[model samples]
Target: MPPRDPSALVAEMSRAEKLSLVRGTADPAERATGYLPGIERLDVPPLRLVDGPLGVRAEGERATAFPATLATAAAFDPALAREQGAAMGREAVAHDQHVLLAPGVNVVRVPHCGRNFEYLSEDPVLSGTVGAALVDGIQSEDVIATVKHYVANNQETSRTQVSAAVDERALREVYLPPFRAAVAAGVGSVMTAYNRVNGTYMSDHADLVGGVLKDEWGFDGYVVSDWYGLATTVGAATAGLDLEMPGVPAPGAEDHEGEWPDGIPDAGHAGLFGDPLAAAIDDGRVPSERLDEMARRVLGQMARIGLLDGRERTGELDSQRHRDLAERVAGRGTVLLENDGVLPLADDADVALLGPHVHEAKLGGGGSSETTPFHSVAPDEGLRARADGTVTTARGVPPVPSRSLFDRLPYLDWGRDDEESDRPEPSLDDAVDAAADADVAVVLVRDATTEAEDRDSLALPGRQDELVRAVAAANDRTVVVLRTGGPVETPWRDDVAAVVEQWYPGQADGDALAAVCYGDRDPGGRLPVTFAPADTYPASDARQFPGVDGTAHYDEGVFVGYRHFDAAGLDPTYPFGHGHSYADFAYGGVTADGTDRVTVPVENTSDRPGREVVQAYVEPPTVEGVDRPDRVFAGASPVELAAGERREVTVSLDDLAVRRYDPDGGWTVDAGTYGIAVGRSARDDRASVAVDR
Candidate 1:
């Protein structure tokens, strides 16, 4: 094959060549392979790609592993996520991959969302910030990073057909921000979602793909279809979806064996080279210039990434640095949701671990987000290694249907011989009785695995809530550690002596959890989403969620999570940005320069070293036609402080800082005095200052 200009090659190619260019070829070793018979004459070697947002996931070959997206968000360190991306990019280059289909930026809206492990957090700002950083890191290593599931792909169940009927405000505020941020960060490619936004499929949605992504956001990258996500090649191609992944074979071609036949369709059916492109050209559905432009963009990305410069390597696939990053991210992403001085157990303290989650640690979720971890560490093993006393782990409660009060009652036996209403009487008495002899009981609670995304309700699943309540009733010094990807309703928040939320920390997650509890490390992570009571949920009415017509309407608008709870004047079980540390910290003397700077002194008041994330929120006085949250997170800074150490942190605010997206359209700053509050969590405030905009 000659080294031809990508544009010239695209222009000179027949229908078959164009089809082959977009479809991914299968690995030689795989029995099931996709063969593109249309472009045999092009004589171009097909580029091999694989599934991944974290690492290359081609079977039969080992690849470097990185922490899951959720784990990276827990780090609260953009630099670290970016470094992980760079490592993944190097691995991609080593594998001779043209694109890395990853950096899943979908927001973690609900706890039971099956794909939550693959995503970052419920907060758009957090997800976007980390996603942008990762994109920068991946591209830096001279490999293309594909930011994916373009819009409103929070859940996995019925994802292909589900219609995300979100309001404009919610769409802009929650669902779309991450992609916008990723585009701004210069990701090389964007993959459209499998579901529909409103009523239009993402691949064929002109407004989303062409209008918002390409025009408004100024994204110059190529758009690819999620595998088999495109209904028709013409519709997708015309809608700015540049590639049809896993190319369909032509009709009657004996050499090819797979889905999509070989041979051009009859004149009426619009053959690959015939009608769609030709008709598209005639009706102005697609201009030749658009095709030329797409080819240029692809070629340009290749050149900029040094893919055309022969800089790719095969040895960079699994480096030590990549493995180290995976461990670091996994360690940092673990969150200590609650603790009452019981944590960081003394080396000599006797510990009793309980719960099914202890032995079967759910690291990451199912589907595209799943990664073959380099190694997995069980919490029981991790804790046993450091404990001086015998670490006795008891299966307190068997795997039951209910994890919380909100789960469907009268558990149906779907996997049983008969569909009997055999609801196992909520029993924690036996588990509590067993814990009577132990000094400290560590109860582990596991969330649902890959079956569904987002919870039917805010409550925890199964009788786990009942179990927690009973165990807490029996044992006063009980600690509950929740292993879930998203926020679960915690009615038993006040009962448990201590709590820790490990958001599906990938692979080495068990070790990270054990390390935090054993004082091997301090917990510095915070919640990315607000945990509201079931009654206070925006879609509190059962009929309001998932809608009647199979379309979920985002009636909450600009107010989501803490935004909705705060605006509605409702209290949450745990507010966003809420996380506790073993040591105490104080915020004093917060002053914002009338212009663009705010300086505050953060003092570690406790007698121990710890890290504190200082959050700044702005509350604009009521304004007409503004559906803005009273308190919006404007700035956040993480500080490491020693005992009694005071550090002065300065935060800058500009026009964008106080600006809110007007309900009508565009962004506008209200001409009123705004309240600037500094806090450890959304509900927990320390000091307030007035700022005039």
Candidate 2:
């Protein structure tokens, strides 16, 4: 039989049943991150929501752990991103989950944003395109994919209280594109951010949610507020928020990231969405039809996923295929930021592995994105397996402390922080000695970031900076590997022989590192976010960042990431899309068709296989009264080439490249000549073409 109509089911549901569908309830299995129970009499199954972007994060369950979304974004390969999404979807379904809270499309506005690792990119076109692919991949598995943190949720500091003062055009052009793309791709759900936009809580914002998203964009999915992110009952209900998560009030009501208060087990339930919503509807504070709409949306998603028909969903976990894919992504996403002929180390040479937790796999950053893999490979172990010569190890500094209050909590700590607590003390002298004695010294350092908090600075935490200097001084051939969630200031970049950016490459971290270091895999990753000093970004001011009083101002408009760098004429530590390869790729010639398409011929000049990301930037026409960036990232295509192979890469310009957001006219195309630059990075332009529109 076909899926039942959601309208009919909503008509049958009473007020109580409708309210139940609108709020989360207790999960009997206690495995899901969130749970929503439908009407039992109508046989509507409860939706099991799991925290998944990196992997399926069902409590106490093991799944295939993939790299950070930032890592995937670095690859600039949507095919890989979609594959990861499908793999995660299957894993969630294996654990009987219905909704996957994933594909966080929020633009990386702040380098210090603790949750930057969870997002895609600073450029909207890249983030939006990749995010939509993830949504398509997840929904293809018949699971509801949630595109989240709604709008302008850039910082983690005071996320629950601080308001992001974004203008209307900024929202349309900079922050809202990714969410819009996800919606356009037919994503099943939208998650509101825990923060506020322009002093109005997103959960209760009618103009954006109800008018812009639902009315203008025609998003036909349910709008669920983030856990404990709801503001008001009637306001949210009337504002087009279809669901409130966790059903009850959390343990620490004020602290969005805090644990359950004192004695509360699992999660608390104060029933804010339960009785309060019903009361509002009964007393006419909220329209009765709004409740019906909520129930219909929930049922609609269930029907779409085949849950209403009691379809059996089975998926593989810890499969060899998934394991290999994990390693493949980690390898492909490895960005070589700098090098001086010291990489792809000699297989027979003695190597010194020096860093904190060389024995532990740097899986990922903390909070909801964490996943417990069946097994993990440490860098030391992986290097030992791959290298033909002796591999000595020494800790360069004390282990970086995971500064999350939630890290100590039982249910939330899925990545096994307890196992890491009793680590042995490190000695700097031993590290220096090891470096001096070895043919090459590999120093691994990482910055700690987690949810519910923002990093104090872009500087590496603890004594790692000191450690890098010491090791570099001891051995001239010091190869520094940064296993961070996002960009960090490399104050000692010039001192090192080479620098590798392996952004939190999940469970296969060790294997990926070994392969890349030993020349088995080429550095295929590129900088997704620009590397800059702590104070160089558009929001360098205290008032613009963590905010003053109550609001954080977004005064820079559309100038974010490389756009900011270009407009301000400031050079970053490393430009966006900058990366190195063992093989060199030469661009022959580039031509554009005045509008939609740009064609470039590229060849691998070196005798090694390589992957090249062909990037195209568009310079919009000069409108007399309008102001725009120096250039906007249009689109890119990743090319795979064998040695001595020549191929033509076609990069289709994004429709939004020449468009400007007009408050009165919506997105409009300026009638003038447009310039398109084709290059490997934001700053390096290989060729240029003009378009008259």
- Tens-digit lDDT track of model 1 for 1-693: 224466766778654455444444444545122222223354444344556765666555556555557767776677778888888877766666656787889876544456666787777777888899989988887767889889987665467667887776677777788898899899988999877888888988888898889989888878877765665655677677766555443223333223221111111222232345556756776776766666556655655665444454543755566656666676666677877777778787677777755664455554444456556667788788778877776655556332221121122222322111343422356577756766777887866555234456556566677778777887778888877756777778788789887776665666676778876667877777666666676755534454556676666666667877887888877788888877789888889886356678999999888878787777777887556787776666778789899999775543334766655867666788988888888888888899776
Q: How much is 324 displaced in model 2, in angstroms?
A: 1.2
Per-candidate Cα RMSD to the true structure, in Å, reads 6.5, 2.6
RMSD of 1: 6.5
Which residues of candidate 2, in runs, are more than 4 Å off?
Answer: 250-270, 408-423
Q: Which 10 successive residues of model 1 have the least lDDT summed?
A: 261-270
Model 2: per-residue Cα lDDT over 634-668, one tens digit each = 99999989998999999988787778898888889
lDDT of 2 at 39: 69
